[model samples]
Target: MKNIVNKTFELFSELEHCNNDQQKWKIEEMDGIMREMSEDELNSVLSARMLNKICQMIEEKKMSMENAILLLKCIGYCTMLKRIRVYCFNDSLVNKRFKTLIVDEYKKKEKKNEKLLVDFCECYISLSIYFPSGLLSVCVPCLQKVAFQKEENEEAQNEVEMALMALSNVKNSEVKKELSLNEITDIIEYHQEHHNLTHLAYQSAWQFLIFRFNMERSLEEVIVNELHFVREAARELEELRECVDWKRREKKKGEKEMKEVLIIGRWLDVIVHFFLSCQLWNEEFFGLIGGIESAFQKAKGEHRGICKECISSFTNIERNRAVTIEDLLKGRAVDAVVKEFQTQTLNNEMTYECLTFLMRVLRRLKEEKDEMGEEKINTIKKKLFEKMEEEGHEDIAISFYEILHFFKRRYDNGLSLDISDYFVNVRENG
Candidate 1:
């Protein structure tokens, strides 16, 4: 690690004296060093002083397109580390300097720098994860300008995709400030009318838009009551069903089918994200339960996990009037979660969601003294305990015990379960 630190400083010194052509190579060399860094090495390098040095270099150097991308890739990688995320969150200059760089590059009227724009989007998305509030207020407008600008070129399409993804990462406060209702309406209509963008691009745009409606309380009524949005969701569900059927029938998906599955998975994500924030669930919307279940059953890998996570959300709806434990049970929520635990290796997020759903169910059932719920609880307990015995899951086991302890004490005291008690552990992945 000391050797790695020395090498990094050496590259920085070389960058200072290097010519533009040589600078590119130096940055590339820097990228390689950062790429090979261990977690501790990354943490070491991502200090305030190092960030200041990086900002100075970015300001001083007339970096080539490739060099700028290389530098940003290194920065992007650092932003992904858990410790570095905490560091970035506490540091305001990192956000401001990078946002200015992205905006300045964006405002340049020469031929568009497509790779730089995408990297800017990627880096900004990473920053937004830690600085969710005001970080994107200025940057998002620039992304929106390019994202909504009509251009029928490959460069335009890729930038639009990245920009939409960046917008999706914007916080609710910034989202409300940056995006207007008319602009939001335009995005929905524009994507519906245009097919020039790839499925991923359109899905990202939708994800961004839905996230806005979900986060901004003012738009909740618009999303829930809007007939057009419901129609679009219905249409997307039909397409999702077709994809689910294809996955069921095909033994080995070719490249095209794999792409199609991924696209469909993104759409599933959009729908789930939308409903996850819905304040109420009407009958017509709830009728789509069958489709959600079928997709969960047939979809593979992460997509299937996404479906299960979505189904898990059904039981825990905080504001929805029509969502009952009985409704969730009938929709086969318990069965889907149980099957997942029995058959699949659950990720942290999925494990938490599934456990949250069951805990809620058990709490409700215990209050009502429902015998069937008792049977279901016994089955889920068996599966979870069996899972606890596996290796590399000490964190999960700890969470399991915490949840059990919470319930035992709550039941003894005749107190209701508070979901907030366990909410902090959801980001345990970090």
Candidate 2:
């Protein structure tokens, strides 16, 4: 720890006096040191003084492509740590200078340094989380151009992925005011039709578009647009269904597949938020209810929770609505929720999500008592109560009580609950 601090100080001093070539070498050394440090060590080393110097190095005009990439990497690492990010954000001069550098780079003619472009996108993304206003204008246009380039190579695909991600992080209303609804439609259309795009890139593209849609459009406008959001969401879910091997019911095996599954899970999560906010409960327009139900039956891990939540939201239609609940209940949705609740250990954020999903199902079953047989409903109630009684789930059961009672007393079931209970549980257990 002492050695890392001393080394950081020495590098800081060397960077101030070094020429361009020596600065490049020292920047590489700094990147290596940062990469090797644990999160604690990195946090400790990124004092306000150290962070300021790093930002200064990034603003250097004569930096080599290699050194630029290295410095971006260093800045990217700094932006990830909350303390360092706060330091960067609070220092207004440093923040504006860094943003100027990024925007100016984006304004230049397309460069040959593909790696530097990718690194810039990634660094901009990390910084945008804390400095969205400063970074969004350059990031949105720069990333959008790359995302639409549709280049058919891995590096291009990687560029598109980072671009999509950088765009997704942006929330500045200044940029949003300039966005055309057609642009949002174009990206979603691209995602739906482009079969060759990598899963990461595909997911990233929709995530950004979805953010823009949810923020810019009201529920009424979403309907007036001819249910574009619902249709596209359904299309993505159907594609996800085709991608999965349903009969196997096997966990997606490899790091790559696991990551894909998790991405799909997160994608479903954002879709859930979109649907809930829009309150687009018409199963007829919200097509592909069956696909969501079928996939939840076989989904494992975090995927299961989101799938179940999707099922919960889709079925949670108003009684007077034109569509019958029976239309969405293609199969035993309650059974999947109960089985997941019974089998899921009292760990993971998924447990809380699944539990909230279960609460919704329980309320729905009680309302339309005829939809599910009394026997099956009682069976589900029994399994849920039994699981809650288990020693490990006591905390969850306690947190579950208020929402459970709210749904029963004819209150607004849409009232939010603290979803952090599971994380708190994990910390205590850890």
Candidate 3:
């Protein structure tokens, strides 16, 4: 069995020489060996010998770019290679050798193929590397390459997908271990640098790490760090979106490039959503709402039009729903966010979206009537109505009146005349 495995490695080496005859014969021999060895033995032989040979060729500079990539594919397709990747990543010598191979390949390429080279580089960095030192500088060029590359080769694409999956699994395991915020940050930074991964990737990786480590880092720490990461990522994505190449891609596919940008944008949205919802749930992370809101405000200011629109919409929906929940317990009104939402009007098509926000806020206020007290609630309602009137939201005013009437009938009896008259008058005047 050992001899047969040796022969198989020898055959693979010969295939590198472009000798078709030898390749065929070697494959035939490999087939017979596979038939003889049990699954365990096959795995052992592949990990011990076959994988080592591939690494050796890379170390010896005997592997071609094409062959090295093909070898990666072969390994990826093999069940044993998955385990081997984990083991090899843990090994300093093996990991260094892999990095060297990828860097060398990148250096040999001309400018025209640089993007392709960078994809390979990202793949190399993403596979086994982890935190502050994983691949930050390395990822920049690789990201540039991904942006530059007009099309993706199968291996490059597959490698990225696989890398994400592996990181996700690692994160899950780390969460069980209960790692610290700094530790989670390290993992995120590592993935960001090496894989040139997006914020979502970082978030996913962090979530998994938290689960894997089973650490008890405060939710505040988690949210703050995540928001910081997202903010930076969003800025970078915005710049990338402005690039001529990226714009060209956008024109070609409308939102294809935008979708890629959204990879980061969506994570930012999640952080905002989580923080606001946390406020209502009375989660410890609620404290970060101020910071999160500031971040969103800055983001909205810096990026007007579509980017601002999407994020603002997200904030509106989250804040409205958050304020309504009874169990989550609302804090002091975020006058700034409310003012911002009111100031940003939508077209007729977006009226419903706007209505949704108003409805959520009203519903929450009604549900928590006892906690908020009649006097404070009425003050808030009056303020909201005045703001709506100022903004010419007659429709909103009318809807509020209807809602007030319903509540007045159900809870306050006919004594809710003030609310009913205000809305009814607004409807009539409009």
Candidate 4:
């Protein structure tokens, strides 16, 4: 077994100078060796030697970029070899192996051997063209080292570009396969760790997963799932914000980090708006919104100068366009709020902001007024006030008063006022 392993290494070593005819001979020899070796023997030998062999060919300048790519493709297709290859190349546990190999190679060379390092980096990048999924796993650390060296090697930069292109193509292919949510999460986690230096790819992967998930379910359903991710992202933002705040006591670096936190906060706000627009109100959901609002309020109080105006504009637009409890009860929207308290709480808001939104929705409903029974409207109004008192928001009482007054003045003078008051009394009695 040892003899066969040594002979295999020798053949790999000779690949650098091997011509087309020699390459054919080497291929045949490798095939014959495979025919004789047990599966276990083959696995052991390949696992121990394949990366070293590839690196040797690279160092010797015998491996063409094209052939390096072909070899990885071949390894990918080899059913018996696929697991080992993925283990070595894609598994995060083996990251240290690639890192060690690159660092050891660098240590063996003189300072002026920068060209050799650049060539090896280029070759490593080429390997990604064949196994793009694994490329980010294996090559990113090495690329980061190169980037850190601050060497102005255009070839090295192009190699990173090419690897990214290949990764993009692989992602497109994966998306078309209708991968499950778990699979998408796995891909995201992998890229998140491996491509930390290039945030665009990670962000793109996240957005793609979200977009695809949204296509299969209503926005309401998507919002429920999004809650989990949103909370996780928000926690990270809070940590980042703390870090920035601490840094602000010393330097200006905090500003850039704060911008990242703000961006994440804005995304969370957008997600909240989506949930609110569907009238999918729940205690937990409201708690999340209240938490964000509180954070924004604190930031504003601290004079942190967050984009409050923009957030207000977005929140108002969402509320005005949002489906109301009445719309849900009438079965007039995609998502229906079925809970009695939820429906009531949604309607009793009286803040200038809330009133403005309510007026807009009420105007639209009146314009499209299909004769809903006065009794049903009264029942809904009663439920709303009862829930408001139950929820301890007495401010809603005044809002209801103003809404009733508006209806009287706008429609039939005093005629509508009596009908509206009748429902209000029924609500109070109930």
Each candidate structure's count of clashing pairs: 0, 0, 27, 1
The TM-score obtained by model 2 is 0.58
- Worst 10-residue lDDT window for candidate 3 reads 421-430
TM-score of 3: 0.37
Global fold similarity of model 1 (TM-score): 0.57
lDDT values for all models: 0.56, 0.53, 0.43, 0.41
Lowest-scoring 10 consecutive residues by lDDT in candidate 2?
421-430
For 124-150, candidate 2 gives per-residue lDDT tens digits of 564544545546655565567667766
TM-score of each: 0.57, 0.58, 0.37, 0.33
**lDDT: worst 10-residue window of model 4:** 332-341
RMSD of 2: 9.9
Candidate 3 runs further than 4 Å off: 1-175, 178-185, 188-260, 272-349, 396-430
Candidate 3 residue lDDT tens string, 167-231: 43332222222223444455455554555554334444433333432234355444445434434
lDDT of candidate model 2 versus the reference: 0.53
Instruction: Tell me the tens digit of each residue's lDDT in model 4 across 4-113.
Output: 65676677667777875676567557655543443355566555357656655655767754465445333332312111223444433223334454455566745545
Model with the higher lDDT, candidate 1 or 3: 1
Which parts of model 1 are misplaced by more than 4 Å?
A: 1-53, 59-66, 73-93, 99-126, 129-137, 175-178, 214-218, 225-273, 287-295, 298-319, 324-331, 341-355, 362-430
- Return whichever of 2 and 4 wins on lDDT: 2
